[model samples]
Target chain A: MHIQATGNVYRAKAVTGIKTVTDILMFGAGGHAAAVSDVIRDIEDFNISGVIDDSPSLQGKCLFGSTVIGGRQQLYMNGLDTMAIFLGIGDNLTRARIARSLGGREFPVLVHPTAHIGTNVSLGEGTVVMPRAIIENGARVGAHCIINNGAVVGHGSVVGDYSHVSGNAVLAGGVNLGERCLIGIGGCVLPNVAIGQDSIVSAGSVANRSAPERHYIMSPGSRIFRRFEK
Target chain B: MHIQATGNVYRAKAVTGIKTVTDILMFGAGGHAAAVSDVIRDIEDFNISGVIDDSPSLQGKCLFGSTVIGGRQQLYMNGLDTMAIFLGIGDNLTRARIARSLGGREFPVLVHPTAHIGTNVSLGEGTVVMPRAIIENGARVGAHCIINNGAVVGHGSVVGDYSHVSGNAVLAGGVNLGERCLIGIGGCVLPNVAIGQDSIVSAGSVANRSAPERHYIMSPGSRIFRRFEK
Candidate 1:
């Protein structure tokens, strides 16, 4: 039941003719959902019809002006075949699990207008690239990934499915991130480094070398280089 | 002789009418120059006329397809009044000194079209905001600064004159960076922290506390938190 993007279907589109606005259902209601909602509002191609959250309390509540229409039950409604869905969740494993649960649903790529996606890049289905994020030329971002605000996926890099490159994180050129990995806030993976599935480069941490699956990088152990004269 | 930007004259312009391309002179031919030139090519407002480097060997050489026409002498040439100048240098002290040397010349603010400058953001004269950089709401970036590639000047942050926020660096909300400071690549300044003049937060470092003038913060000495089975 895992929904893999067939071909280059989710690549960013260049609108050459009349604009068509597609109604999309946002799949979460957390902080990550709010961030993706902001980006979706900025992009001209997508209209947020409703937010889908499983919480009974949130069901009928307003999320960023969109109605919390219903939960996974709405997925069974007719007319879902024509509508697109976007995963606004941030957690790697949870996002991956939910993405796998969907059956043949159209998951469209949502890229903020301010984000720069270079030529020859392949963005997989249901991936949401946030404001000011950069995916350099020839990079491949797998399905259901979140390239968060100001994050950089450098040239020729491969971000496996369901990975989250958090705000301001930098995956330097040719770095490979395995499925369900989370590069935390302000984390940096140095050039050509490869981290396996479920690995984490912690916030403000630098991964200068590769690590195997499920490794955690602890960092920002500071030293005062110079306390200058007053 | 220091050329101060009069009023809000250097703000990013919205071209609604017929496009008029301004011929711009690049002030340096270094690596920073190449980066800014790449951004300028993406924005449709300005055309790169030539490059100016003080290095004698670089004179008449090519920089990113622009000819290294001449050095400081071109600053006084006829028709110079119409051409805009951009300081393509990265060094904080050197950029400041050179900016002060120019008198009455128009130093335009060059922001890549892909960069997101939010409401009420003020980018100072001669400042170059590189690709995918973000200046959030009510933030004020000072004159002649480099907000480098994928760098985030968070909401309400203040970056003082001649500073460089390096690639993928994050200045969290309300962070204050003083004049001639350098926040290195992947450096993260935590929310509301203030670093005084000539300070440096080194690459991959996190400045979680305020520092006084001329301080150097070093970081990213790492440790393994968890290593998993292959």
Candidate 2:
């Protein structure tokens, strides 16, 4: 498979027939992993070989038709050179930690066929754009990030590494999210707002202003007494 | 076209190339109609013949290249047998009234190509599932409903007739919405919650419990002292 980098986006070109399917080792076998597995099954070119989960109980169990092989140590068994990995962990920090531990290994960016990714969108390695997620024009999604079901990353928005934009969340045009940020379900970040690293905009909360690092922009009612006004 | 009924769901089977393009008359010339029109254009088998609106200002005006002809009387002029109708009105009550007046007239269910519909999903006539909307497994959407942009109908949820699930709204698994209900933008109805008839869930509000009939569950701040508490 030949990958051509245009601007910041990497577009993969298939070598017809020979590269019909690529084996992918899934990291994490939780609920998010199940969802990601559904998307991987829908996508024609990718195949899940096995799941890698830390939980001992899940080690021999099957998740979405794929067996949980072992923990992070299983990566060595598959050989990173031949096996591509998909980060299935939902938490931003844990996903980032696992990605960093892999050294410089690049994971394939998985986008569901139903997702409407507009022109000039840049998706980093190991980023999984879920079903019906819209990453609009000029939006940049960082590595190991999860743009979950029906989420909309509006035009010119920048989602930093290891961030998770939950289902039905909307980051309006030109919005910037720093690393490890969590834009919760049904959350709406207004245009041009910047959310600092490790901050979390809770579900259904509308962020009209910038939030500092490690802040929690909870629901509107809770925001009244909170230190951060916006 | 042979429409096979399996339980509550109707699956329409295509009859080769003979019935490729379907002539559809849109019954609203408003902004919501324009959004629906965009989806109609994207669909391969459907074609918008014209628009029908009661307002004189909108009449003869073009909406997405389709001109507004007249009022409900225009349906007779166009011959309803030849052209299918789509209700593009945004208001739940207004859309319900319009659908009732057009008794026995079935409308085509429009699903945007980018929208992800899971297995065994049942969508009713005149229902419009907009771009990036996710209708998960076993979910049932009623007639003339609007599942707007980036909205999600979670697994096994039931949305009543003439209802509107607004943009970025999330109706979690097994939730039930009564007839003519409006789940507003960024609103979320938690799992198994039931919203009564003609109820309005205001934008960004989270409904953790059931709402009674003719109620309005406003945003978080407004939910503090409401008469009809969910």
Candidate 3:
């Protein structure tokens, strides 16, 4: 796999020895991963190493200047380099699967110092908390999660690994989310709501009740999004 | 005029630079000043000599262990030693009034390292940019302001002095606000919305139009709070 240097600062783990050559390996090369790659590139940090994907159409080509570095079997950097990693998989399950496969390796969590973690909270490794996101006190987020830009995780919430909480989404207090979930942009998950794993919450929708694992579309009048006044 | 030896960190600023038998001076001992005093105490980097206020009800009482130093006229610490001064006023006109009253004595601007700032953003002295607040490119924020936690300022936005952008509020591209404006929590101001100074926007409101430079109440429809399965 070839990595075309983009003249940007390489992203490294914040740890002492790892920051010197902050290269980053991408886990998935899909649309969500592409968007995350854009943020990483724009952030003035992190160098993209290469992607590891099993898609036949992408196996031979480069995504974001990094070659598809073959399948899961061929992952790893031949012990020649030290780098951090970001899980670019969309679904939480995919993220969890990939994370377990690579758990022995180091994937430092990336919390943009700009994220607002209120009074007391614990966010685990491989989680990327983006700019302006708010994780209120008593919130617990597991590994390999993406709390995107301007997202809000209200107080006392628990999010399992491989969950992608998109930009401007709000999760009220006591909300519980299972593994491999995707909470889309501008979505609101009400307080005390529980969602099972492998769920896809659509953008701008309001989730008020308990939802089992998998996809649930908000029907008409389920949520209100429009307001116009000075 | 007197430092009462209050133990709280907020009162410690009153004792910062006082040798044996020290006197403290302060200004605008109000709700805003109370919080500002707390931060100053945390700074421990400055000296609070005394206070200056004409409010009759608070004139004789001791705040943070420092007595109101006989109004604005007697604010000068006759023979006391001080490292710096603090402008505890929350109003733009009044804070500026007191700063001008000091004639360049120096009040520190506190910019939290966690605050996200874009290129060409302007901030004034004594302004505190709270954690996770995003000051976008070319945004101008004036003096003695409180850009609170998780607040977002979009590109080309102009925010006036002593303004408080509450938590999780989003000001889309090019929003302009006047002095002493208070934007409520979880509010969103659409692009190019011009709001005058001293304006107050309630929580969970999505403002799409220009507002006068005064208090504006927003009534957002009932939010579903969360999404769940049907």
Which prediction has the highest DockQ against the true structure?
A: 1
Interface RMSD of 3: 7.7
Docking class of 2: incorrect
Contacts from the true interface found in each model, as a fraction, amount to: 0.57, 0.31, 0.05
Off by over 4 Å in 3: A1-21, A24-109, A113-127, A131-188, A191-207, A210-230, B1-25, B75-85, B92-105, B112-121, B130-139, B149-157, B167-175, B190-198, B208-217, B220-230
State which candidate has the highest TM-score. Answer: 2
Instruction: Say which prediction, candidate 1 or candidate 2, comes out ahead on TM-score.
Output: 2
Best by lDDT: 1
lDDT of 2 by residue, A1-230 (tens): 21222332222221112234478888887556766776776675677888888888888897667888888777776264557778888778888998888865548777776677777777777788877777888898887889988789999999998999988889999999999999877888999999999999987788999999999987643211111222
- Residue B32 CA error for candidate 2 (Å)? 4.1
Residue B59 lDDT, candidate 3, scale 0-100: 74
User: How far is A12's C-alpha from truth in model 3 (Å)?
Assistant: 11
Candidate 3: give its CA RMSD in angstroms.
11.6
Name the lDDT of candidate 2: 0.76
lDDT of 3 by residue, B1-230 (tens): 21121112211222222332222245678876676565555545444666667777777778875677666655554553333556666656677666666764544565444555654456665676665566654577776677776687765678887777777677766789888777777766756888876677666665657877665747445666557767
TM-score of chain B of each: 0.86, 0.86, 0.65
lDDT of each: 0.78, 0.76, 0.64
Between prediction 1 and prediction 3, which has the larger lDDT?
1
